[model samples]
Target: MISQLFSGIAVLSLIVLLLILLLRRLKQPYFIAYIAAGILLGPHAFNIIHEPDVIKQAGEIGIIILMFSIGSEIDLEYLTRNFYKPLLITFVQILMSFICMYSIGAYLDWKITIILLTTFIISLSSSAIVFQYLARTGEIKSQLGMITCGVLLMQDILVIPMMLTLNFMSGNTVSMQQLIKVCAGGLLMILFLRGAITKRLFKIPMQKELTADHELQIFIGFSICFTMAWISGWFGLSTAFGAFAAGILIGHDKATHWLGESLIPFRVFFMSFFFLAVGLQLNINFFIENAATIILISFTVIFINSLINTILFKLAENSWRDSLYGGALLSQIGEFSFILMTMAAALKLVENYTYQITLAVITLTMLLTTIWLMIIQRLIYRLS
Candidate 1:
């Protein structure tokens, strides 16, 4: 038993170590490499290791910590000031991306469920990835970066209701009345929590870091996240919605700065596991098997996705450089896309081949995006 445990540690360690080396050498973002490492150990070609049930179960914690940390960093004043731009851009992006992608789905003769999933997925950019990239590049204070941040936050907020709508629509048991209740409850929760309830939380002082306060803060935070999640579930919304609502609430609190500082270390540590888990689920052979179709769809999505995002950003009174910046930040598929596809597959709305194809495309896009960004960085900075 001891040997088994040690071997697992060694394997995980080696995977992360290899990723670090690749990241340094390639001058690419570590996230791409991390996901690649997970794929290397996945049961596809390597067949050397599988992400056991235990590991996947543990990944749940990673998700929470990540969402929680995001909440803490959210500056209510900053975000609110920039909100209108993101709100408009996000709505346009979602509306246009769905309409355009859904048309392609029609040509592909995709089923309604598959079409819906595609629409949902295409509307999103990876929040975790984009935020981290902006921070790392020291652009978080730049106007373009600030706009992107607001847009991403708006996207997350938009997704909450969309998720509830999807859940209601996707269910066999849901009635019109039931759907109305869910929507109403969600709207009410968002307003109540984000407005009055959260304002009260912000009114409290956390000027001093009292002893043992860190533990209490974490408990309070996790409680709020879990509680919101539970309420969302009860109202037929997904757990992510609750997490988002939790973030918005936490963001409002004046003590959010300290909360951010306290939670970041934990977020970084655990989210590493989340990325690794994503990698371990990808099978190279499966991706290769569907290479032709996956490439076609992925490239098409990337091009159009970038175009739509660019157009929206420009319309929002942003510089052309800012438009391209937004495009570059988004020029790929994301985690939520895969989650929606998986759900569709389970419901027989899509086949396994569809899910595999989307995953392959998303991975390729993500990998390519790093290179895409670097090559354009100089030109973008000059123009901006």
Candidate 2:
């Protein structure tokens, strides 16, 4: 078993390396390479790695770490000072998303729950992809980047209520206890953020002692991240939110800045797993069988989402160029939407066929996002 694991790792590394080299030459993002590696090694292809569950779990950890890194880098004061812009943008975007999805659902005689679910799914853009791109381009600290990050943070916070609504729609009784716990958890987080913003809440026990200790930095960083995640999960909140909060705390402390740097290698390694899992989850047969319909729906989703966000951002006082670029950045369906779909499926809110179609559409949109962004960039350049 150990030998097989080692062999699988070797093959996966080789394939991913080769693809990365190819994509580099083509001037494409590394994520494409990771996803391609997954597809090639997945069941539809060589099927070297038969178990996807392990990869998925590891990928989730990557997300948590990614959120933590983002949180650490976030200028909380900047976000709070300009919070209203993103709030307004996100609010209008969600409203428009719902209206648009509802009209289509009504026209097709589809159920209200399906419309709501679809709206929720499309309203969210891939935080992982957008953030990674922003960071790669050194724009993460730029004004537009901050605004985009704020909008994404708002969506993440809103996921709790979305989950509750889905539960109620699916006939699952959301117990009062659960609601109370969620509220309490939210309140606690608010307090924590408020305190962190106001002043230094506390300090790491051995800040000076741990500053130069490279080995201990890794363990300490992971502990802070996962411990916060565990706390957030206990409160019925998104674990990623917990990780982000942990990062904010770390960011507030100058002594612990090295923690973020220490975790970069881990983040890259684990994040590959997340993208790989996405590729593994792609049902090649189903996608091929419904290729035309899937492609149409995916493009429609990208177009509508991009339009809505662009209009909303413009209303928020951004220039048309930035708005269009931001919209393009957020056009793809997010990772969290997959979680929503799984929940909807388990509750039988959507048929298996619908679920598969949604999955394929989401994966395809993610795959196409980089190309879409490039197109948008060229268009903007030509227009300018």
Candidate 3:
């Protein structure tokens, strides 16, 4: 069994290396390349992985690491400095998305849970993708960029509540008192941590101390993340909530910067595998058979969502150009959608077909986001 595991890793690594080389030459993003590699190596294609369940478990760890990194790197001070704009956008967008998606789901006779999950998945934009593009294009400090950043941050914050809501709705037989207890527990945990930080009850290691033992510093960060995750689970919250909270706690510590840096390589390695696992679940034949439906659905969702968001931004006193820019950038489904969808599947909230379709739609939207942004830019320039 160990030999088979080693053989599988070797094949997967070889495939990843070759794809990375080719994708680099083509200038494709790492996530796309990883997904492509999975398609080629997955059971739907080459059938190289004999134990996909193992890969799936490892991928979950990658997600936990990714969430931890997100939490730790979040610059709350910067976000607070420019809070209202993003908060407004995030609130309005989610409100509109929920109303619209709920109406559609009801009309189609879907389950309430399915409708709720769909609203959360499609309404939120991909912060990782949008922020990367904005930074690469040197727009991170621009007015529109700041608004985009603020909105993305707000969406991420919403993930905690969404996770809790999912848990409550998961058909588990829990009393209202238990639910209240969980909520109170989470709130108390936050307060306790805040008080501790204020009182300096737990001092962050000094840089000089960590500098002498780099490995120890990294372990400390992981220890904090995992510990918080376990505590969160104990309170009936998702491990991600705890991990993210752990990040926000240590994120502000000066000595923790090196810890965050040290985890980068591991995060990247694991995240790649996470995307690969998503690809492995792709039913290539199903996707191919429904290629036209996928395209039409993707186009419709992107178009309609962008149009609604642009109007909302405009109503908020943003210029048409900026509104359109923000809308276009946010039209695609985000990485969080994948996480939520996986959770929803586990809870049996969505059908097998709905899961496949949503995954394919998200992938298509992400791929087109760049092209869509360029097109919007050209249109704005021409109009100006």
Best by TM-score: 2
Tell me the tens digit of each residue's lDDT in model 2 across 263-352.
999999999999999888887888899999999999999999999998888888889999999999989999999889989999999999
Decreasing lDDT order of the candidates:
2, 3, 1
In order, what lDDT does every prediction score?
A: 0.70, 0.92, 0.77
Residue by residue across 1-384, what tens digits does model 3's lDDT show? Answer: 568778878987888888888878977666777778777888889888756667667766666666677667666566556678778878888888888888988899978887788888888787657765775678866777767767776787677678667877896655687678678867877786666556655657566888778788788878988888888777766566677677767876766677777777877787777778767877788899889989998887788779877987787679999999888999998877887897888887778888899988887887777778778989999988
> Each model's RMSD to truth, in Å?
3.1, 1.3, 3.4
Model 1 misplaced stretches (Cα beyond 4 Å): 3-5, 48-54, 157-171, 176-178, 196-217, 251-256, 381-384
Residue-by-residue lDDT tens digits, candidate 1, 187-219: 877677656544574343454652248886666
- For every model shown, the clashing-pair count is 3, 0, 0
Cand. 1 Cα-lDDT: 0.70
State candidate 2's TM-score.
0.97
Scored by lDDT, the top model is 2
Clashes of 3: 0
